[model samples]
Target: MTISNESDPFYKRLSLNLISIGLIAAALYIAQDILLPLFFSMLLAALLLPAVKFLQRKKIPKIVSIILSLTISLVLVFGILYFLTTQVLNFLDDSDMIEDKFNGLIRDAQRWVSQNFHVGIRKQNQYIHDTAEKIKTSGPALVGQTFLSLTEIFSYLIFIPIYTFLLLYYKDLIKKFLVDSFRNSSEHQVVTILQECQNVSQHYILGLLIEMTIVFSLNAAGFLILGIPYAIFLALVGALLNLIPYVGMLVANIFCMIITLISSPDISNVLWVGVVLMAVQFIDNNFLMPLIVGSKVRINALATIVGVLIGGALCGVPGMFLAIPGVAVLKVIFDRVDGLKAWGTLMGDPGADKQREKLKDAIH
Candidate 1:
């Protein structure tokens, strides 16, 4: 039943692949409301699978292992929430001081701008005054909305661990079903791809955790040294945001600048804070991440960006966070398929291609 080369079946197969991709995209779009939580659950399960397996190997009962793993996860979540709560309360307690410092900084900046550019300081002051009044009027509503958001977040938090444990407990059944449903020839390929996916996801998630820890620790130390108010809160926010990829660092830097301007009211402190952020970013981009993440997936920057955008558009922040590893898994599966190898190449790291070329030249 093999199609001979003269039949030119490649084009037909390619068309089929395109059709399948379109169908999958449409299905996902239609089902995203339910799919998002399932996707998050799967991701959490994937990240914790290695730990679960280790516990199993240690002769832990499956139920006990799931319980223990989820308990640790819950404790970590609560600890972070408690820390954030404490830091936020401290910030609120010093609200009046923060507001006075912010106002003084704004006045100084307005005066400097007037002196240098001959602009009307009074109009600028009026603008600031109007903005403050608007904020004052809307602040309570905004606070109410924020509380609602927090309630929703906690609701999601409660489900994630429960879902993660169920996934872990049923992982074997899921794998067995997948393998048994596939054709004999395809089963090995499917299993290999799944294992590779697990490895890729584990590396990405663990690498991200390491990266966040280092970034948060360094930023917190710098902020504390610089006497920045709410350093713990800001550092934690920055670390969590860093999981979003690409623009996360920029957001953290902007936040730090705003806090520095409002808290210190000193141009030197603001500039120093910016410098610290840049230094941390420089180290992260150049040294720490490369050493830690280290060629696990070999996905290119362009593909990564495109994947993140697609994921974000599909499922918000969780989608963005999951996108790269998801794409990597897709690429790995595509590479193993004879008809889809071209797509795998298209998604792969250009550096890998260069290395292949270099090896070919050496062989020649």
Candidate 2:
């Protein structure tokens, strides 16, 4: 006869852990609208905390310091947004030219396809006409969905600032709550987790900003050297979009290529755009990321990818941006908590011998 696994301590613990994880995932998904803004605001407050404290050091009132910190952050954020918006509006102002260029590109594509693949122009036209008809049929639904998405975005914008301010204002209360929630035996662990989480947020967000600025400068320089129109706009767009992880740069590359093709009237410039962006990506992945963003978060590649995919599935792009930091924070918690050291290992890099040994000792 066999022994029952359910009677084992490991099995009992595993079951409880799985149930807790399932409940947490469901809660996050269901409460995303309320939680997402709060989470984002938490990150913002963490990033700006030093500035707030510095102002207080200068003998400024705490309330005024908080307002000043928030004001500077908001101005920098909205200034970039305003610039991007103006660029888009300027692009839209030349709609007739864009349409003409698009049609010309389509014609060029059809000709190239005919020559290379022996597809008839008439057949291609028929395929395009059918696709257009399908799009026309679904256009109204698409429009409604877009409108709803925009409304949701604006609502988040309103809530995020309010939440951020409140979070900063009540940070001490929250810290006290965390300390009181744990027993004396675990109070130090709770405090360690809080400090680690704050450090992770600060480093991760600050590193990303530095990375983005460098990337934007490089991209702008490359585009300017190639004499690409709207060079700065495309560079900024590409740099900002690259924040979304693996999928982002690919989309940015395609977008920049399409814009280059449309505006430059040089097919070769499209290829150069791809080449330049790829070179930047290589530098970013191999050099910049390792030195900057990946220094604090030692997540394994597989875990990062899986986390990003799961985050995107659960909460879309914002979730994708949050995934790495979320995982980093979770890893920190897991390493400190009993019975979860293995999970910390699973999320962390494999070749970190010192870290692995430390984890092993903690587990023991």
Top-scoring candidate (TM-score): 2
Q: For residue 14, what is the lDDT in candidate 1? A: 79
CA shift at 230, candidate 2, in angstroms?
A: 1.9
**Clash pairs, model 2 backbone:** none
The C-alpha TM-scores of every prediction are 0.81, 0.91
lDDT of 1 by residue, 257-346 (tens): 887678765668878777877888887865565555645767777888898888888766767887877888899888888889998989
Give me the candidate number with maximum lDDT.
Answer: 2
Off-target runs (Cα >4 Å) in candidate 2 are 1-7, 112-120, 351-364
lDDT of 2 at 355: 48
Worst 10 residues of 1 by lDDT: 352-361
Report the C-alpha lDDT of model 2 over 1-364, residue by residue, as the tens digit.
Answer: 7768666888788898899988987988998888888888988999989999999899999889898999889999999899899988887787798789989989999999999999999999999999999999999999998998898799787998888888888899999999998966799999999999999999999999999999999999998998888888889989998898888899999999988888777779889889889999888876677667776888888888999898888988888998888999999999999999988988988664454455457658
Kindly state the number of residue pairs that clash in model 1. 0
